[model samples]
Target: MAADLEQPVAGALPVKRTFLLIGTIVIAEPLAATILFPFIYMMISDFGTVQERYVGFWAGLITSAFFVPQMLMATLLGMISDRLGRKPVLIIGLLGSALCVFLFGLSRSLSWAILSRALCGLFNANAGVSRTAIGELAHNRGLNQGRAFSLFGFCNSIGYVIGPLIGGYLAKPAQKFSWIQSGNLFDQYPYLLPCVVSSLYSIIVSVIAILLLDETNQGISYPTLTGSTVSEETPSEALAEQDPLLTRLKVAAARIGPRNSTWYCIIGVGCVSLHAIIFDEIYPIFAASAGDHGLQFTSKDIATSLSVMGPIIFVAQLVLYPFLNDRFSSLGLWRTSAAVLAVVYPLFSLLPHISENHQGSSRIVQWVILLVLLAIRFTANVVAYTSISVLLNQVVAPEKRGTIMGLGQTAISLGRAFGPALGGTIWSWSLGNGLPPPFDFHLLYVIELLLALAQVISSLGLAKSQSVYL
Candidate 1:
């Protein structure tokens, strides 16, 4: 399979089409996941399940709920895709996410809402499956894998942009728009519209996948000399079953690839994911909180700020990333981006202070500063995410791509799951304790900076040991 993948393809046109299909399908999960961010604080508050002071904690829990099950299931799902083929797992994940989104919007209580989000996470193995498919497709077709993954990141930025818009604007339609009067579905279920829209988008993408997407697992396509099809596991399973315990361990280790490089890449991905998710989960809660500690922004304001990230990330991933990748290579770009994030994250803590001190005409200046900082943060995010993903694909063996990608996704899911719960807990503790400057709201940012710095250290290690692959 590895030798076959090295051969050149006839043209780029078909490869482009496959990338498009995979990219489009990959958008649904992120869209469904992020659509709740704009309105989630309000949603938790409306549930009346906890004191206003503790809202951040519950909000964080809800945010983390979507990732917890994903962390547990991603590796298994990836391994399943290795056996069952990628298309089926991808479609099932999409459909499950769509159903869960609708259920989440209809949830009237906090427990139900968390359950809905958790189920959504359970259904989403799309991230790993899509990455594996794209990696395989790019390698077999002789396409630039870096460019293909960057395009995947571009589609994700689009979803991030659109999801918040839907959540921000459509969340309380009855209150926002005069036509959406009281006593109707929109009024009764205030957050339902955004979920419906997000769910429908996923369904549309699933339909497209069913019609146009082809199976990229080459093992499934080839026939053996005896006219039976070869499976990804046939050789490995046979060896593991027949060998002694020591040899079985060797087989397992080989399946995981070069341990030092592979584990370093996974850790790098996890750290970046942790800091990114903490920012996403905390930003809105911080913006909505009252007094001097927060920006005290409404859902629309938070949404507007987040919406700006889409264009910045879109341009960064599609235009700037490819150029940077060419000049710096994936590891270099990853290191630089991680260093930028370390610098950029701490700046966010200054925004509330800036808004507090600045007033009237200076309000415009505050908004500008806020947007600029967000732009920088998101751009670094796109570069780091795309580069790390490309490196992950490069480090794994061809037959083990599915399982390895799944493990990578598992690392990301674990970071995402832990980040929100930790951020929310810290935010709530800071507010409740009435602590000093650095220990107060600034604490989360400090932790974020540390995570980014850790990523930089990991990148340095990879640079010394793994640059040969680049």
Candidate 2:
């Protein structure tokens, strides 16, 4: 971590290996984040402590536990990364996440599970630092900033694809898979198999990062976008000359330094994160809930669909996202995707209706519709997140990149902290209380659509330029 080198110009950059390393970082966090989603409610159920009617409430809180500490500590870690360098922070976050998530899997009760998740969130600042590292790495390579960030987004899509497979298939190995069920730790902990697998992968990746990853901080930050070199004085001076609104944002992020485009990107990510989390928390609960209330799916059934969907999302990102940055403004592309999501959420809400109205049709038909709608919705959201991440790195100088990106993660994490809890309670209330049509599980999607529209509107306030930093 302490190894240092003079900042390299474009031709001297380590393109392939650096991408591989950061790509692992990008995928590992989400892998850990989502691997538990398929079975978390079931884990809580196994505790047998929460009543059936309120399981939704507890499940949401358990999921939210990971993000709450992440929200609180992201910026602090980012600052730490800036001072100490990205490699050490990355190692700490990766190893810490592995330990914490492994602890959660070994937990005997809900309280222990929640504590494990919270500690995991507190220590895993990998998302922010990884972005920080990618931004600097790509910048040093004189690459299209969008291309580097797009690759990370693509890896994220891969994570979504793989995480659920591990969660769905590997969890409860004692019950789901035979062979050594009698002797394995999974027989005792039940959920430990997947966590153990994910933790081992994380530990392996951390060791690779420790050995191969280089420190990006040179104690100086370069300010340029789209490979256009410029003077360091260009950014703050450009903001000071803009209208009063820009000045206000500058003041808001002044403590962190160089807030203009970065702040806009963070606001955009926050809106998307809020909508994304509601989907994350609400979907599985709605799917796994019993009776005629929802899909009434088993954990394996949910995993089956996700394993299918994750690959589709990955291919779509690979095929479609590469063309985006070249053709559209970052904010424009993001807002357009957000608008598409606004439209798709309603389609997502139509699934239960299809089930009720067409009882004689193949159940496969409903699953197809659900998969299509989810693919569209998640793909759009992923594009928005990736594009916004690129915009964040572009708008901020390299020196402050880690801190600002951490702040961005903090903002998104803050939205997510409320998301699981609020979405869980709402879904629980809808299920338990039989709220009217819109207020039912259907209402969660509706609110998300509305938030997407608002995100579109808020994005209009951002600079519409292709590249803003220089």
**Model 1: lDDT of residue 139:** 54
The CA lDDT at 333 in model 2 is 82
CA lDDT of each prediction against the hidden true structure: 0.82, 0.75
Model 1 Cα lDDT, one tens digit per residue, 283-305: 88888887878888889998888
Over 1-470, each residue of candidate 2 has an lDDT whose tens digit, in order, gives: 01122334442335667778888987887787778888888888889888887888898898789899999988988899888888888888889989998998898888898899899888765688888888876655445666677778888777766777788788788776767458677788888888888899889999998888766654433334333343344543443453343444345445444444556678888988888888877777777875555676788888887777776677656667766666877777888998999999766666765675434564678888888887887788778988888767756755677889899999888888888898888777776566677777677778888989878976876654323322
Best by TM-score: 1
TM-scores of all candidate predictions against the true structure: 0.90, 0.87
Clashes of each: 0, 0
